[model samples]
Target: MTDASISHLQVLDWGLLIYDDALKLQEALVSERIAELSPDRLILVEHPPVVTIGRSGSLDDLRESEEAINRKGASVFHVDRGGMATFHGPGQLVAYPIVKLQTKDLRLYLQMLLETVAAVLRSYGLASEFRGRNPGVWAGAAKIASVGVACRRWVTYHGIALNVNADLRWFESINPCGDPDGKVTSMERELGQSVDMAEVKDRFTRAFCRIFGYATPPEVRQRPTERPSWLVLSPSCTESIDRMESVLSWLRLSTVCQSARCPNLGECFARGTATFMILGTICTRTCRFCAVDKGKPDAVDGGEPERIAQAVQLLRLKHAVITSVTRDDLPDGGAEHFVRTVEKVRECCPDVSVEVLVPDFRGSLKALQRICDIRPDVFNHNVETVKRLYPIVRPKARYQRSLGILEYAGKHGLIVKSGIMLGLGETEQEILEAITDLRRTGCSFLTLGQYLAPSKEHFPVSRYVSPAEFEEWAQIARSEGFKKVAAGPLVRSSYRAGEMVCSMRQPLKSYQSKG
Candidate 1:
């Protein structure tokens, strides 16, 4: 039931205090609220690295001993909350609702806490849900927030802890919330940047007040009247997508743009451009974030190159982007297939610029050299994300190895291009370092796009990066010497590829003429 009878809540933001101190404050507030000495108050605090175990929790839940945790600059506490072990540290926003429980039912109170945080996360476009096993907010396989509460004669304290940007390594030192297999992720990790804790606190206070019937939500934005400018497809694009699907299905050829569930699929196909996944639809590598089907793929289609080239000619396209699922099982990692496709496209649509976005070929010099020898108009590869995130994001793909492929292509006089998705939990410094690494490999063009979480099953989108942040990164990339830059929330590797080739037309023509 809505607490529409409640009028207001006093919110206290206590920044970066020790866990014990906050616990003491919660105790005091709980007493005051029960005595009617204070209003229904909410306390927001960022705790120093500490792990708190609930009433029934055991010391065995702590992966590290008290002495070890103390030495590492964190502390452990036995608390009166209702969950097992949970870690709180810098970058995480912890909320303690020192409110008189409007309902005598404990279940409803806990669900309210979960809803309050879930509502706040949803406002930022992050999907937070509670699976039956975990009585908290989860996004995909990662737990975004935990709810634990206590009641002293129906006055509640110790409300919720939602990770805004916490360091996740600390969660590893304990069987957090009694699940050793459960993974902990933060808002920063999910959204791809460090959000202002103060701002998040304000948003949370507003959201909590609204959920508990204390206040109405203020206007932040209106329902969009138009499509997101970047995602706007031509009026005819839908018909084109239908036509494109029919052709692909008939030929049994695959496109990553389709299989990956890229948001730009309709727009790209409608525009008669596609990033063809030539080898097969099934990807060998199971990236946490990719939506591509993962399993054993079918045998390579020998006639794929001819069929793709014919499709290009039939569409009368000016550019064709060919990418592939990583085929680690192959001897040459599908390098020869790339050669066949490029040659076929050039022979059929000679003027159509062929951009091959290839895998690292298992870091083989021979494979890189083989594709470089064919001399496609533009050679593109994607680093996908910054190095630190590779372990979690692209487990099988090495950051350095991918760069080597792009570097080799550039050295051989091909106009090299590489790109990454922003907000993969990469810091500004890490992103700049990644950009510098790409530039060092002689990559001249870059495509920096927001990483969309293809579905709830995939890695949850950490944050909905604003258009302005994308622009800022684009400027930094150009300043760092990227010749052509495409940075935006809706940009994907093959999205607006025709424009990329068009921008480099003068340089490409001059280079080809010299050759």
Candidate 2:
């Protein structure tokens, strides 16, 4: 049951996603599959109640008015698939396979999809068959699964939806598959019992792999064992490194450069710059992609902000960058601590411009406003990755919440900035979308860097993006209307805080070191 050409398949289980967001992910992956940049991938997810009208569908297919449907807390969309009207909601297993078709015969692909669903149903001791005219799997006279797909350049997307334990009442709103007399049912109804969705997903994955001639897919692609030549860092001056370390130790200060194991640590330290991580070293949230310690963080130190200011003074830093571990344990998310730190830095080094790469402050507008009152040179927050990867990459954070923070700061006349890491299995289209989103929020500065896995225990790096590719991204970001773009293998949120601000020739230029 294997084709020599089909060596591997990747399965991405997105727990729960909005209908539109999942479509964007499919569109992004379709392009990658067409370009042969990525392997075949299956996106598994469940959507909140949504009725999607395909190319052949019309408003007539919907039994309820669009307004009536809205009142029921369901969404409606016109999609580009081959079917008519289809309803997707919780308790339904939706699978979108982004695969490079070996042949252009779409009928064969569609039939395979039906076969996969039928086989999975059979595993539950339910017999299903393909009914007349319509493209779907049926149990007796009732539909158990709906099949529809769209293809681009011989790459396929918009796959099948199987009714495992879905509530059949939602189907009453639409003439399922545009059929006037279609009957829809779920495995729970057919078997006269409830079915475990997790078990159904497992069976479907196995059935899909076996029928499609693919070997068992790995949960995640294995990371490359060796580092690329470009990632090889140049040697730094030991005297400069020792001097900065001595200063940081004397002040009892912490820097993300050391805690996050930033690749630019040696280079930035040699240049007398560091992104000070305040509050405490331990983070309350356990983001899979970060290396910072995660635990119940200690009480905030009242004297820590003064030490950070003293470190800025001793180092003669022109642009002092401040960041902190996510302190969700605090009521204001340590917003007051940020205010105190900024005030102390201003008192100690009036000439030095301040930049705070802060957290989302747990989406508290009042908390963010506290920092905006002080008005640092830059208000930076990392969206970190695409919305599609939120559940797996940084499960504790919300994408819209992060964006809201940036948008709120921008509205208050702050020079907003944000960063994102690459090679976490994200497609180029996704990155471009992120850049556009940032610009819309009036984020003037952007940092695009390669994500390095801190350890095997952390999220694995999907691939090592080449330097040329990174430069190309930088140009694309600038073209998106960003005022300043810092993109490279080693670029970070505060990689070159002073230089980026000075190059802009803004008011912060006065703070640049003359030497």
Candidate 2 wrong stretches, greater than 4 Å: 1-210, 213-223, 504-515
What TM-score goes with each of the models?
0.58, 0.60
What tens-digit string does per-residue lDDT give for candidate 1 at 1-515? 33555555766666666777677657755765676655677777788899888986888898889899889999889988888889888888888877787678888878878888888888888987897666789977899998788989888888788888788888888987999798988888888998788788778878787667776442221112223565444354677787887887887677887787777777777675788888988889988778888899888889999999988887777789989988998999999999888888877987787888988888989888878777766789999998876766787999888888888888888889988987554667888899999999999889988877675455544345678989998999899898889988878888878878766742333332111
Off by over 4 Å in 1: 1-236, 503-515
Model 2 RMSD in Å is 15.6
Model 2, 40-143: lDDT tens per residue?
A: 88888899999999999989999999999999999999999988999999999999999888867888888888999999988878888986589999999989
Local distance difference test values of all predictions, in order = 0.79, 0.85
The clash tally of candidate 1 reads 4
